[model samples]
Target: MTVPLAATDFHADLDLALRLADAADEQSLPRFDAADLEVSLKADHSHVTDADLATEQAIRDILHAERPDDGILGEEFGAEGVTSRQWIIDPIDGTANFLRGVPLWGTMIALAVDGVPQVGVVSMPALGRRWWASAGDGSWTATSDGARRLSVSTVDSLDEASVSFQSISQWAQAGKTPELLALAERVWRDRAYGDIFSYMLLAEGRIDMVAEFDVKEYDIAAAVPIVREAGGRMTAFDGTETLSALSALATNGILHDSFLSLFRDLPRA
Candidate 1:
């Protein structure tokens, strides 16, 4: 018989994740929309700003000083110090938005233990908002008013649910426009909230579902715990519980299987 993995406390790790976000915010927030900000294109044609590099390096510097044994996988910089315990960083989750003076962008940080994200943090400094969660601790968010525990909407029927499809072009590019349209038709409303904010809205119970394609571990790792802790479910488009699958579908826990069923006939990614 196989035994379940023992549950571990992540309070400390969650604290560290929040601190990492603070460091990231300090480094990147000031650079937002700066006239002197430097910009460049990565080989993949994605935007990379000086803020991205500085924010990621700031987080890395803290991990190196405090959690030296843990590994890191960042969007701006490649992986480092391979280990079972890894810190995933996306200095700026929406670089284009950031450069365009949109406040939807933020910094993401997560601590994945043995491949499962145990702690997650998303800090939108420009908006003066933040959200975070750790295994068993429950998800929470903060604004100018104060902090409150997060909970996903209880809507169980797709016909009554609200959804966010990050990009229509992304759906077309993946050849899943038919499936996307079908799902959108089933829902009461559909919007393109885009980027990390969409998932955070799901956690806040303001939205019922979020589906997007062409993502990476750093793109969604920090969202896994936040969504789950908020009483929601998140998985790859093919129904796998992994961050590396390059796709994501998140919904209130009651609506997860139903959402996955919509894509059941599609080929696995």
Candidate 2:
């Protein structure tokens, strides 16, 4: 049975997620540039590291103790338990960058009820930044300076939009490269600022839109609420409200329909 969470409960979960992120940062940051770091590849051909396993294990330990009834789906360890309330975790969202000593990676954690994300936390220790949101509690970010509420940009048209699509390869692989390139030509500017950073930038009002392919649920679950609470919109390329979608399209709400229109007739892989 699915028991709904009240606003206070969501806030409490948000706090717990933040604490988990702290532990994640501790486990991941020290390994970022370690001389003895261990790296391996997953079945999907994506990179994974010792830091990823350790950080996810630490988080799983806490969730196992604190919310044993809740289910968990993690990038490194896979899913466990079965419940309407599940914690989705991507211990390290950008392992490729982490391995390269780039600062574009972060830890993503989210609580979803009946498959709807209600609380989210993204911590980028290397970048010294964190962003979070709980349903109805608003989105927020903490930096070296301090914390502040987040909001998406007000850009209302593709002609005035600054967008990030993660990568050209994703579109090419999806058989939508021409469509992506055409959309890029219509937008004010385009960047390949792939990974969770692009969504965080969208939440911070620094970027107007983000669309990507070949992403898993854990890859995006934590970002959905952060974007939604920041006055932005997130949906699959088909315009559905779902985190399970293989592709994602996020924008400052005003531009969602316009953005969706661009891919209306394009073939998606």
State which candidate has the highest lDDT: 1
RMSD of each: 2.6, 2.7
Which residue segments of model 2 deviate by more than 4 Å?
A: 1-8, 265-269
lDDT (Cα, 0-100) at 109 in candidate 2: 99
Pairs with backbone N, CA or C atoms under 3 Å apart (clashes), candidate 2: none
Alpha-carbon local distance difference test for all models: 0.91, 0.90
10 residues in a row with least lDDT, candidate 2: 1-10
lDDT of 1: 0.91
lDDT of predicted model 2: 0.90
Worst 10 residues of 1 by lDDT: 1-10
On the 0 to 100 scale, the lDDT of residue 47 in model 1 is: 93
- Per-residue accuracy of model 2 over 1-269 as CA lDDT, tens digit each: 11145543587898899999999998999999898999998898989899999999999999999999999999999999974899999999999999999999999999998888889999999988999998888899986678899999999888999999888889999987777877888899999898999999999999999999888999999999999999999998889887877999989889999988877855566
